[model samples]
Target: MKSIFDQRRERGGGTREAGPDRATVLSISSHVVRGAVGNRAVVFALESLGHQVWSVPTITLPWHPGHGAGTQIVPDDTAFEAVCRDLAGSPFALEIEAVITGYFASKAQVEASAGLIAALRRTNPDLVYCLDPVLGDEGRLYRPPEVLAAIRESLMPLANLATPNRFELEFLTGLGAHDNGDLIDAARTLGCPQVLVTSAFAMLSGSIGNLLVGERSAELAEHRLIANGPNGGGDLTAALYLARLLEGQSPEKALRLATASVFEIVARTARTGHNEMALQKEAASLSHPMAMVQMRTLAGAKKR
Candidate 1:
């Protein structure tokens, strides 16, 4: 068996002698025992792309609540903060180049996550932070009001990128978005360097889109809408997009590839008639997605 150092080196392309040569991403989210959601989906997606992933779970469940209610095991606030502190002071902290957060179980977890982000930034100022506000979907809220308030107040300002679906974006800005133009405007108001608004308006019939709004540009990657898709698409998309960016792919390419991968997985899972995402079976889609995504540039995406 390979030593721990050798294993880390293989995952991150870093050696004990030469130190970290590739980026390691820290993903904070929920953990499910039987499904591909939260940290399970994100960790697998990132690792499949040859990046070392450090997972921090805000809560644990037997399965996603969507399939029906299950037991939720959440850590105590004090102990959770201590774990965050431990990671902050870890020697491997500097090896982390990106952080992605999703699915906070409580307000305290959101605060602790913000603290960890602040601590990591102290050592690596250029850390890429992606916030996937797991607040709600289809115009409904999943997390409580205080958790939403904490994420809006604490994490939004610190994010380098944000991946919020149309409903979550509306909640974040407190503005109603009727179309892609409204989403572009709201995304600019977010003040993050980049905002990827998923579930955007697709021009074509029977399709869906992921709109990437940057400081000076906007692009949309659309695919056929898969009916009754699984619950892990947002988590998988955020992790895969971050992984591609760490690999030095441009924003457009990253969006296209991530969208394609997610579309492929969802389509495959639908075909297999699985309630949870088929991440383990369709692992190849993560790195080398063969699905074709329609890419287009929005004409009126102006600089702020």
Candidate 2:
């Protein structure tokens, strides 16, 4: 017997043809088509949401060259920057309904990506930006100090919503993450309008998961933390959360869907110990397997 994730990939009865209605999403990331943990998970999640994704791959990949696998950077920063600028200037009018951004391998990529976001917003102010500040995780930095610096100074303030785990949360806020006072306070001060934090392993004891999502400032709803845990989770969390929010679900409802959907997917994925992304191609049957988490508004606040 195969895992739920594996089952989905099977013929007929599987999720092979299952998923959302018909939403369009633009996925902007580095080496997007490559088989890495991030983009692979993202592609499947969006498609599962029933959205058609149009990607703007920032670089070419022979394959995901991870540690010891030998990394190579070509396509000079100047060339990459030019492409992004041209993309932003395209006369073809971007058909994007929603946008998601992730990892930047260099400072040039960061600046260019941020500029693209600004350009996209200018083109369609109502568009939603779902950003994953992949600067680092678990107190470790993924990019050089300059790249992190660039993200902090350039891209963050432009996001409508952000999906960052606890460690990334610390870099974003510069506070002691261990203290609830510092952590919660930091959540209230981030650049985006909504900040979603996936607490680290330390916050999890067993089959339980604890995550936080809150408004930056002058918010109507109270901050949230879902204590129910799931396996191979965060990617699905951010995608479902963004989809719900973009579809006009309130923050609380968005969190609910995100949590529920992520849990369902993980429960399914756990059955497949193989590559985490095998679920990508079988989205239809599995995307929205759970019910919505109902949220009540706090009902009062000042505009920041």
Candidate 3:
């Protein structure tokens, strides 16, 4: 199988430049100098889709923890809060139409981020806030309990959209989602206007699904499962989905495209035997993915 990188190279690096009318997005997440995860993945994906991104790092690491522990640098509370305050007061903050947050280093950082969101929303009442609670996966909590509490109590309510995996959803909701119905119930109960749950129950055998639950719609976008996919898939998904929505695509269309992009990039990365997501090499996939994604409409209940 031809790698996604090869296909992109064959097309002479099919990257789209941001247009003047593109909305500016603020992405606050962890930063790794050498890998495509956190802000690296999110910023690249948004830019590839012709959106400008203002990136802020909650923490800096040499690489993702999955690649083995490296240097982790988190700013002190005072310094972090200062920066957030500066951004909030800056005139440029009003230009940001959306904000996406992931992998906060501390509870203080989460609080500072919530403050920034509030400040921005004050200026732009329709600011889109996507909270991807990057707490943990596989039935474990990687962040401190306090960080989880801050995200749930302070950040979740402010979020217009949320992308939480099955494990993270369980951590946020304190309920066991044993099936799709349970997942839907938990998502609705979480109270986010739009919730996209990754790693949800796939109806098709040997497939993975991105289940989107909204006020009036429930849809699942499924693709073939790839083994040992690289990290940052969730980050990429959240970025692409948010970008699509900001571009005025319908929720279901955004879900399909985001799911296809992540699936294609992950499958390509696995084929190349890479430990990190090849987001830069697969920029074309982010903008114009050709991967096949099966989208289905499921029974949705009215929001309570």
Model 3 per-residue lDDT tens digits across residues 165-271: 99999889987888777788889888888899999889999998999998767899999999998999999999998887777666889899999999999999999
- Badly placed stretches (over 4 Å) of model 3 are 1-21, 301-304
Task: For candidate 3, report its TM-score.
Answer: 0.92
The best-first sequence of candidates by lDDT reads: 1, 3, 2
lDDT of 1 by residue, 146-228 (tens): 99999999999999889999999999998788788889989889988789999999999999999999877899999999998
Residue lDDT tens for model 2, 178-293: 53345556666774666776553222224333344454322211222333322235665677766665444556655656665555555455455533434554354245555333
Note the clash tally of each candidate. Answer: 0, 7, 0
Clashes of 3: 0
RMSD of candidates 1 onward, in order: 5.9, 9.4, 7.4
Alpha-carbon deviation at 182 in model 1, angstroms: 0.4
Local distance difference test, each candidate = 0.87, 0.58, 0.87
